[model samples]
Target: MKRRLLLVSNSTLHGGGYLQHFASNLTRRILFVPYALHDRDAYSKTARDKFKTLGYEVDSVHETPDPVDAVRKAEGIFIGGGNTFRLLKSLYDSKLVTEIRKRVLEDGIPYMGSSAGTNVSTISINTTNDMPIVYPPTFAAIGLVPFNINPHYLDADPNSKHMGETREQRIVQYHEEPDTPCVLGLREGSMLLVEGSKATLLGSTKARLFQRGKHTTEYEPGSDLSFLLTDAQ
Candidate 1:
């Protein structure tokens, strides 16, 4: 059966937001997969509790005997955001990134992701402004989406000394690769509604679109997800 995926970093779970989107569509099947937590029990408690509150059958698998099989059976996968670097590392170490790509693109599984989750869907997660709390061998990502995603846009503190590079700066760096588009900056509360090969941003405000060595445009949310869609795949 086909499913709709909702990927996000944070949400209040009230109204028809991200949580409601998943909770309301419980019939098909739902999976709350968190990549932030290293502790298996912690991941279980965090994901299971929230999903169970919505009365859905949610399971957390820290290490699967066969990850490929597990992914194939899952109808919908909701990837929550945390540290982009950590998540990408886990994906590479566990070989879940390949399985995820197959399930979402080749197998046609509806996939949802937010923030860090969205960052990993692109070719690489280097553009994210979050600190590299953890490191993995490779910088490769799921590559389900072409453009990198910068979550929590327009809200970053200008005075912070977090080091690394800002989203804008990263995109400027990305411009070094003329072939690669800069990145897509998504504000909180914004989501991409993707069906089959088509995608559209659904929200009130427009997202910021940036390209390396190019212009930046403020695209209204729900305008047309085609930009992200084209960039992602």
Candidate 2:
């Protein structure tokens, strides 16, 4: 079975619902991961309400006695965004990381994620823009995708006088040490539609690609990005 993934940069656009893009394909039971949010119940309620309108049943894994069992039975999985460190801790503590990865990578279950969720879907969480308020078991993640993903990625703001290192500069530093996989700077309102080993850049914004010692490239919307799926294994 081939993996089916919808990795989004953000849940909401400028003024749209975060899950609005998935309104058309909403006919399955989704296991929602709400551990990232401080209020898991509230997060689940909001997600349920939004997905319910589209004819989908949503339940938070935290509500279940065995989160891994829920993932095993779920038709699809939706990982909500929040604090990356907290989210990764919950995934490892619950041992859902292994179960979810097995289902999505081996059983070919459909998966959807946004922001911090997408950050953990990659090989590592080093590229995330979130502050690490908590310590995770490790930076290791699901590895559904080979490279690192920098969600909500931004370009250098020239007008600002903050004198802080830009997002791109930080990512460049991430690769300076050694063996850092390429990072995809996915902009807001954009997503990567992955089917099998093929991935396509979706939405209006272009994705900025960061490679070690190579010039950054821009992939326009509707471009083929299947090359990114090449497994390092």
Candidate 3:
């Protein structure tokens, strides 16, 4: 079975409502993973309420007795954003990583992720901007996609007074490691819609691509990104 994924950079746009940008793409009944936040109930409620307006019923994995079984029975899976490390650790602790991978890759369930959710969908969480509030057994993620992602990617502001490593510079540092995967800097309000072997850029902004030993490239909305699915580290 081919994978079906909707990887979003951010859940809420600057002026838009929660998940309002891609509400139309969501499945009818979603199994939500709210492990990223400290308060799972609040996170779950927020997701449920938001998805409800979109005509989707959301059941959080935190409320389920067996998260793995939830993944098995879910029509679609939606992972909300918070801390990437916490989310990955929870998934590892609950042993939902492999089950989710199987559900999406073999069972072909629709997988939707935002921000930190998008980070874990990639090969590893090394590209995440979140601090390590907690640690997982390994950096390895679900590997739903072949590469890594830096969601809510920001460009260097030329007028900024605060001097710090830009998002691009950090990703460039990542490429310095031997055999590191390609990184996609998904800007806010942008998303990647993957259907089988084909991946397309969606939303209003352009996504920046960073690969080892190459200059960064910018892809506009509606651009074909299928090449990324095969070019793994």
Candidate 4:
């Protein structure tokens, strides 16, 4: 089977329920990653309640002793939004990072993530907007996507008097390293769907792509972004 992935900018849009964007596509039996949130149980429960409404059973990996086995057995994986650093650290501490990569990449199972989850699903979490609440061994991630994701991407507020580095500037700084790949600035309500080597942008919002030296590009919804899959690392 082809590797299937849904990387979402956020679980809820301005007027939508949790995971409303994926309600129609979700299937039964999904493994939920809740370590990013401060309250793992609450976060998992919220996700469980939401998915349950759609007839999907959600299980949090935090409740399992053998997370690797859990990932191997799960039909699909759904990681919720929160702090990227915390999420990566939890995956490493549980030693399930490699197992997840294997199941989602080598094994070709369906996987989904939102916010911080989206951050870790990419090459690295270096582009995440969240502060480093805690430390992970490294910023490296699953590399499921060739580029990094900057979730909740914001454009410069022209009306604001507070002058700080714009989101664009920060991402450009992240790419200062000669080898960093492009960064996807996913606005709220935007998502990327990947099946095998193909990727497509979804939702009504436009997304920004930041590359080195070149001007950022805004991709319309339903645009074919499969080219990103083959981008050089």
Candidate 5:
């Protein structure tokens, strides 16, 4: 079976309603995972309400007794943004990683993720910008994609006086590690749509690519990124 994924950098764009940017691409029935946020109920309700506006129905895993079972029956899965550590911990606690991997990779269910949610869809959560408020058993994620992702990526402002490292510099640091996979700096309002072995950049902005020993490259909205899928392996 071919994997179907939509990895979004951010859910809400500036001056846009929740998920309004890609509303038309979502499945009609979605199983939402709200584990990243502290208040699961409120998060679930927010997702439910927003999805409703898009003519979609959401079933939050937090409300179910068997989240693994929910994954089995879901037509599609959507994981919302928040703290990456917390979300990974919750997924570990509930043991949904393997099940979700199976559902998307083998069962061909569509998997959508935003921000922190997008972080966990990669090889590991090491590239996430979120603080480690909680620890999971490991940083290993669903590995739906071969590379890592840095969501909400921002370009360095040349005029700013801040001394902190730029997003690109931090990703460069990640490449210092031996055998680390390539990283995609997914700018806000941008997304990667993957179908089987093909991946395409979508939405309003371009994405930055960081490879271990190569020059950083920029890809536009309609650029084909299938090479990242095959080349990274």
Candidate 6:
């Protein structure tokens, strides 16, 4: 099986956009899952427009009873970025995550996701701040990959206090887990491409790897990221 997965940060899929170009030559039928959007109509329209711009026949399964059917038929699945908690909740409630795991792991259909989509590749979504913003049922992720993604990574702030913890601090708290999943801090244009069991980092700027309750070295962009995963073993 030709197994592959393209995990990216957030982006609008325009005609000449990064996602559109990457997916253009691969397949014509791209089924987009946009469960992250709380507003149904807004989500559906976004899905339609993005896929249409990418020259794909888009379908929004939010109104359908058999979203799994759509998942099974698609040549590729593109999961858009939004609220991570919301995305996982919808998948959990609909039992779509299970089907997705089988599709990518068993069937070898290429899986592509940005932001929240990338978050679901790990074993859990507890690390996401989007959780507190929206109360979604916390469930283990699909485990398509072992690493937890922290997209839109930014430096810690030393400004006047806002009272609660910052994103960086939250991530620090997440590291206290008994067995921490490798952290991949990706910028907006950053991505991790997995073919077989190897994952390669593709994009501009460096990606930070965090593990064992400590901040690891920064990985220069445009390099093979397989070492990050294999080295963990």
Give me the runs in candidate 6 sitting further than 4 Å from their true place.
11-16, 133-137, 158-163, 213-215
The lDDT values for all models are: 0.65, 0.85, 0.87, 0.83, 0.88, 0.73
Estimate the TM-score for candidate 5.
0.93
Q: Which ranges of candidate 1 are over 4 A from the true structure?
A: 1-5, 9-16, 19-28, 155-166, 231-233
Ranking by lDDT: 5, 3, 2, 4, 6, 1
Please tell me which model should have the higher lDDT, number 2 or number 3: 3
Runs off by more than 4 Å, candidate 4: 11-26
What is the total number of backbone clashes in candidate 3?
A: 0
Cα RMSD of predicted structure 2: 2.3
Off by over 4 Å in 2: 11-27
Give me candidate 3's TM-score against the actual structure.
0.93
Better of 1 and 6 by TM-score: 6
* Among all candidates shown, the one with the greatest lDDT: 5
Model 2: per-residue Cα lDDT over 1-233, one tens digit each: 47888889984312124345543364368888998889999999988887777667888898999887898888788888998899999999999889999999898878888888888899989998888999998999999998989988888888999988999999999989688899999998788888887889987799999988888899998999999888652
Q: Quote the lDDT for 164 in model 6.
A: 81
Alpha-carbon RMSD to native, per candidate: 3.5, 2.3, 2.4, 2.4, 2.4, 2.5
Displacement of residue 125 (Cα, Å) in model 1 is 0.8
Clashing pairs in 4: none
Candidate 2 local Cα displacement, residue 158, angstroms: 0.8
Ten consecutive residues with minimal summed lDDT in candidate 1?
Answer: 7-16
TM-score (all chains, Cα) for each model:
0.81, 0.93, 0.93, 0.93, 0.93, 0.87
